[model samples]
Target: MKKQRVVAFVPIKLNSQRLPMKNILPLGEYSLSWYIFDSLLKVKDIDDVYVFCSDEEIKKHIPSQVKFLKRDRYLDGDLVKGQEIYQSFIESVDSDIYILSHTTSPFLAANTIEKALSKMLLEDYDSALSVQKKQTFAWFEEKPLNYELNNIPRTQDITPVFIETSGFFMFRKNIFEGYRRRIGFKPFLQEVDDVEAIDIDTKEDYEFAIQVYEQVKQRAYINN
Candidate 1:
């Protein structure tokens, strides 16, 4: 059997409504987007890493290992759906397997990405997604979603809920082309720790990520 081509892409935009210039904002020694780009480059199975953005200035901050794919400005609109951006990029890039990731998920490690790929390759899974497992009581629409009101069970006894994290989505090219979705019929839910699943969306999220990053750095220093 021929070896399949695997590629990863992260969509980026210069402007943000919630957090202004969040991608370019300072985080540790590099910009906020630097960590994810670095993580993707370290993935052994990924053939190439791309930063899909409409702006040309992003090229300066991104690592040389990552390529820049210029996208249409219209796709950067706040009203534009993520699917539209995803579809446009998938059409432009040809690969057997695609890893769709985001810059906000800076703490997502390279080993986790390799594990997701290994699960798909070894287990014959059609798709793989990074998720966060939670065992706490969850409620939705003013009703108990995970637990019953009549019989309240301990958190440990309750079934664990897996939340689809924005860290990464790995899928076969055929899945996207056929279903027009990132997930396939058979998806391997790769559960990650809370720290790894941190996605920076708002101001609070960004601040929390910075603290997490500092603590992570301190731990690494102590270990070294």
Candidate 2:
């Protein structure tokens, strides 16, 4: 059997309302985008990794080893959907699978991405998405319909729902060949905890992520 050709696509914009230049902002020693890019690059199965950005200043900070996809002015707005950028990337690259990842997800591990990709291929699923399972009692319209105490059953026992982490997505190129969206039929789920799947959208989010990263790094050091 032939090995699958996988390309990792990361989309970033210069003008961010929530957090200005969040991608280029320093997380630890390197820019947050670089961490995510480097992590994906370390994955053995991923053949190519491309960073799509609009600002040339942001490109200057990225390593030369990584490839770049310049975004047109029309697609540089905050309102522009990320899916559009992803579709354009798919058209530019020739690969069996495309792995879409966000630069904000700095804590995304290489092992997790590889596992998700492996599961998607082995199970013959059309796509795989990273999701976080909600455990707390969720409600709407101020109603206490489904009440559960401290010893409540697992979320699956009540109403199991997965929130999209927007961290990573693995899918075949053919799935997005004709469609405008990234999702497809026969999609598989890769369950991830909230901490590892943190996405930086605001200044508060960035600070919180820093704390998470420090804790994770310290724990890893101790374990190793």
Candidate 3:
């Protein structure tokens, strides 16, 4: 039996309109991207961890032990979609499983990544995306169908639906052999708590993530 090869890829760009140099922004002792990189490194079965960035500052902040892939100008702009970065990583590396993570998710735990990958492998799914369960009455148009004035059920009684975090995505490389995006058929959902799905897109988001991290750390300490 051959060991499964899982490669983690992180796409980071230099220009962020919301928070300038957000990826390298200091969280605690290390930069934001470093936390994500280090978190992936701690995962049990991950074969490699690569940080793909166009900024020289990001490269400097990251340790030498972690792999670094210099992103081209074509893939470095703010307007470029995440799919393009993911595709660039796929074209560069060869692995059975590819894990794409965002540098902004400082609170992403190693255990979550391991569990998601294990579930995907065990169930033989083509992909696994991290999601959070939502129970609110959603609407596509103006009219409400599920919850009417006459029949309004408690929010807790409603069926929960999963929403992708857009922070982490994993898939078999072969499943997207010809495709350019990360999403694919036979995709599995790795449900995560809403608190853990903090994606730092702005200053407020970054501050909120810090608070969440502190709370989690305190809780873990109390439990232990």
lDDT (Cα atoms) of all candidates against the true structure: 0.92, 0.80, 0.80
Off by over 4 Å in 3: 145-150, 218-224
Clashes of each: 0, 0, 0
In the range 1-224, model 2's lDDT, one tens digit per residue, is 88888888887787777788788888777888887787788888888988877666777766677788787777777687877777677777789888899888888888888888887767788888889987557765775335555556665677665789978988888888867546778788888877767989999999998888788879989999
Give the 10-residue window scoring lowest on summed lDDT in candidate 2: 143-152
Locate the minimum summed-lDDT window of 10 residues in model 1. Answer: 56-65
Q: TM-scores across all candidates? A: 0.96, 0.87, 0.89
lDDT of 2 at 134: 73
Query: What tens digits encode model 1's per-residue C-alpha lDDT throughout 42-109?
Result: 98888999999999888877798899999999988999998899899999999999999999999999
What is candidate 3's CA lDDT for residue 46? 90
Q: Predictions ranked by TM-score, top down? A: 1, 3, 2
Report the lDDT of model 1 for residue 37. 89
Worst 10 residues of 3 by lDDT: 138-147
List the candidate 1 regions with Cα displacement exceeding 4 Å: none
